[model samples]
Target chain A: MFDGITPQLLFGQLLIGVINGSFYAMLAMGLAIIFGLMHVVNFAHGAQYMLGAFVAWLLLSTFGVPYWGALILAPLVVAIFGIAMERLILKPIANLDHLYSLLVTYAATLVIEGLIRQQYGSTGLPYSSPLPGGVNLGFMFMPWYRLWVVVFSVVTCLATWLLIEHTKLGAYLRAANESPEVVESFGINVPRMMTLTYGFGVGLAGLSGVLAAPIYQVSPSMGSSLMITIFAVVVIGGMGSIAGAILTGYTLGIVEGLTKVFYPEAANLVIFFIMLLALIFRPSGLFSGTEKS
Target chain B: MLDDTTAPLLEVRDLRAWYAESQALQGVTFDVRPGELVTLIGRNGAGKTTTLRSIMGIVKNRKGSIRFEGNELIGRRTFQIARLGLAYCPEERGIFSSLSVRENLTLPPHLKSGGMSDEELLKAFPNLRARAGSRGTSLSGGEQQMLAIARILRNGCRFLLLDEPSEGLAPVIVKEIGAQLRRLKAQGYTILLVEQNLNFARSVADRHVVIEHGAVVDQLSNEDLAADMDRVKTYLGV
Candidate 1:
């Protein structure tokens, strides 16, 4: 069973795992934040990710812009879209049950995916790797752009964690989640905070899309397939714990990668299997210390 | 400690408040002088909570005028009302379960001017200091109540609208809370407390206002309260 195992191959798979982990970490972080603070499952996350990739592709292909510029401009563009969705779509139903939010976000996802499909078609568009070449690390060859994705995502995750956990604004965000009325009584505008948090959460998904575009083929449905796996990661990690989501994402990615090496047939089903096990043993997920919202 | 010369700290006139389509308070009127301990006593469904919520602008369907230091509160948001020197502690205690005792006490965004410090909170409820690192959910019910009050005081709101601060607490803890309220009053803070516990109300309140069917049924000072048991029983259903 272990005859084909090699350091070079293992290292390559590890790099791939890390790259996949980066996306998982970013996406799960967003889902966890939105679900935890705002109590919305944000089913539109996948569509938002797809939208970010599309925006980058559109800017690069339509206007002859560079990938470097697309990286910054695309996420900002997607963030604005997210803000619009929060203000116009989600705000009205903020007081309603979580199912309403889920339904609304699901509808939004459908509309977004449909519009993009209409404009761009279902074919996967090619995007040339802007940061070409790789570094040979003796045991494994690491592509420069893949390494960039990992570094960039780590930075993004850490920054988000710091913003939510360390700062005064973060304190307000947490306070609002705990008791909106009490936070309001403390002179903090909770509605504004809700809008910004939704924007920020969706913005993370958008950022991940930009990072993912060069690695995967850009298409309308790019985020849809990945969204299911990320959701599994969230469930396995827990929806309310940000650090838990990120850690579970990266860890599960590695575990999945290892499974791919040992038994390629089991690679796709590994996350789901783990999720089933977790649900049976710890329905609240690995790091969910308390009952979920 | 409320001086007759100073303007009223909180004034409500013909206030109407509701929950969804059901009206909870109708044409309620009252005033809280600065540095006064005013108690609102009534049966469970008599709109005591609604009156407090309306004054804090927590109720969505509310009408009539509420003035805190001469500022209109009818259209203001709860946080804005709080920023204007009003704090509300609901009957549920509203402790942040994820946060520790110290974090819960210090979590409010804006600190009130001349509010109690962490040292003061620890002194007022020393048990909180002993359990500063413990999560809010892990604390006993009485400890949670103490944490809630300590949190609001730390946030620095001068005018407190405390809803049933004594409900469900142990007798010893209720006494501690009463002592703290008296201390807060002596420090020149204005309090409007809504309580079902008559003994708790009698311990700290300077005056009592009873509500029945959302309207003011009676008002009495501590002197009158000492002599009038029948009125208390009738209005408060005690």
Candidate 2:
């Protein structure tokens, strides 16, 4: 392994790992927020992500919208769809057991994916990079778009963190997560808050999809393929923990990336293996302490 | 300072509530005036808490009327009812564990114009000021109870429904809470309190409503309560 490994290869893999980590972090944060507030796993997240990519692709091909326009427009469109779905489908079963919600969203995922698959078919569609070209970093050649994805993801994540941790509305979200009834009795509309929270979470996933479209081909199966890994990240981070999800997601992505360099066969299995170990030892989660809101 | 001629600020009439299929409040009826502090005195499981929950719209499957300032509250959501100026401080002292003491204090949005300022609240409860950055759950029992009541006061809600504010506190703390209730009442806040402690009730309340098996069994003035302590004790099964 050492014989074949070069500085360029090591740094190249590291950058790729960070890029993958950014996507993971974004998706996991969304999952955690939705789960924290409504206790809904939002299985439709994957489908919504696929929809984001498709929306971006459609915008460019049909209406001549730029990559910049789709970046904002795609997520907004997906979020609106999410809000409607929450009100029509998720709200009714909100009081039921957690399993009912999971099954319902899982069903929604199938429906959404099936509809997209019907229209777009199984082939991958290309999304041209908005920030094209690369810069030579001494160690490795870095694509501007790839660097943009990492920087954009970090900023988005930081903004979301500030929104939840520092703002008044964030305080409401945190309190409502603990006990919605108590929060409501204080004159806050918890039901509306729930709907918006679902939308926000779904929007984050949509944003992640747009970011991934330039790097990977936009395909229907793209989201579903990544869902398992995201779920594993969420579980290992501890359910409904924002900081935990973000930190664990990046760590797992990097670890998996490094594994590909050292032991190619183990790359795919590493996240699940860690997840299993986490479940066995710290069943609550590796970061349950930070799981408060 | 009891005024019988003044219209009741909150009138609860034959309110019936259920938790799933089991009924909790069965035809419970009472009223609190604009500036009076009333206590609902009952033994455990006599629906004292249920009455408050129904009024606050926490118990969803509730029937009958809860009129606050002449506005019917039965059809309204909890938040809507709260917006109409009724605030609840629950028995469990619903301080969000995830929030800091400061966050907990400012959690509820102001519903009216007369809420106590933050400076005033801090002056009133110095412990809260000291633990402003501390997580709400880190507080002691008395501190948690104080934080619960303090949060509601910031909302400027005139009518307050407080359940067991003194239940798990020390004697000194109970007295302090009683003093706070008196001050609120003097400042024109109407309160409907649920209590198992008759002494606590007698200390701050102008009137008492005795509940038994989810209905109002008897009503008494402060004078009537003082004159008939033994009978009231028996009525409460104390």
The candidate maximizing DockQ is 2
Candidate 1 has an fnat equal to 0.69
The list of candidate 2 runs beyond 4 A from truth reads none
With a 3 Å backbone cut-off (N, CA, C), the pairs that clash in candidate 2 are none
Q: Mark the 10 consecutive residues where model 2 chain A has the least summed lDDT.
A: A284-293
lDDT of 2 by residue, A111-132 (tens): 9888888998989999989888
Q: Which ranges in model 1 have alpha carbons more than 4 Å from their true place? A: A62-65, A290-293, B1-6
Task: Name the top TM-score candidate.
Answer: 2
Candidate 1, residues B1-238, lDDT tens digits: the string is: 4456768888889988889889888899888888899999999899999898888888878998988889999998887888888888889988877666777878775555677777887888888988998777789988898888888887777888899999988899899889889988888888999988888898899889989999888888877887987879887765
Cα-based lDDT at residue A217, candidate 1: 90
